[model samples]
Target: MKIDFEKIAEEHIEGFKGGEGRLDTRNYVDDRARIMYSTLRPGPKSGKHPHAGSFEVMYVVSGELTVHYDGSEEIIKMGQVHYCPNGHQHWFENKTDHDVIYFAVVPTLG
Candidate 1:
């Protein structure tokens, strides 16, 4: 079906996944997946962690995000997508002066 993010309330998170700083997120979660709209201020990071039972895919809406995963780093800009496979470690950082806006989805596994 359709999910309207505007109807979702924002959740302000600090040190998400054990990282530094805060992020604004609106999320919808079900038994199978978690879909979220997220924004990170400059100089903030999503803590590095491993996805043990799911794969996460993030789509950049605007600005830039530096993604670290599987011993590598990638810069994802607007219109780009990054995916971290299940059982992999990953994190994201916003290093620019602008806010990093993105949509991320994680699908749960059995």
Candidate 2:
């Protein structure tokens, strides 16, 4: 199956997961998975949260992102991918002046 992101409506989320600033995204979500094309504005971040029953995979498309995973920090630049396995906690931060664009997928587990 193919997904055309250009047709999807973008949503702006403020303080996503209890973090600062905003996140702009176009999403495709269902019971099986959550897929999104997103942009993180400078100074905004995704709050640290546990994966719980699912795992997330994020691919950086442009710019860079700082990830705090399980008490450590990681820098994910363009062409890099970051994965957060189930039961782990992680968050993303955009600290540069440019926007950070990425694609992400979160799959639900049985």
Candidate 3:
């Protein structure tokens, strides 16, 4: 079957916000691969958190976010992709005027 990405976005990812930890799964194939999107409010932080199994890949679709990772920080802007490897803890904040939006592939426990 074919997929309609636009309709999927409206149905799965619309009205998402940060600080609320909204993670909507658009599509999942084989239970191992998935697509998800998130939206963040201005000046919103993800709080101090750690990934027990860190193997996440993300792409910033719009706005900007400062990621606090491994004792340092980096500003991830639009059209940029970032990877969070294993054992690395990170938190992110929206440091821009507009809302921050991003998509990622996260591996979940079976």
Which segments of candidate 2 are over 4 A away from where they belong?
Answer: none
Tell me which residue pairs clash in candidate 2: none
Model 1 has an lDDT value of 0.94
- Model 3 lDDT per residue over 1-110, tens place: 55544556433333333233433345434455556666676755765556655466778989887888878998899999777776677777777778878887767544
The digit string of per-residue lDDT tens for model 1 on 70-97 reads: 9899999999999998889999999899
The candidates, ranked best first by lDDT, are 2, 1, 3
Candidate 3 residue spans exceeding 4 A from truth: 1-34
Instruction: Give lDDT per model, in order.
Output: 0.94, 0.95, 0.66
Which structure among the candidates has the greatest TM-score? 2
Residue 80 of model 2 has an lDDT of: 99
What is the alpha-carbon lDDT for the whole of candidate 2? 0.95
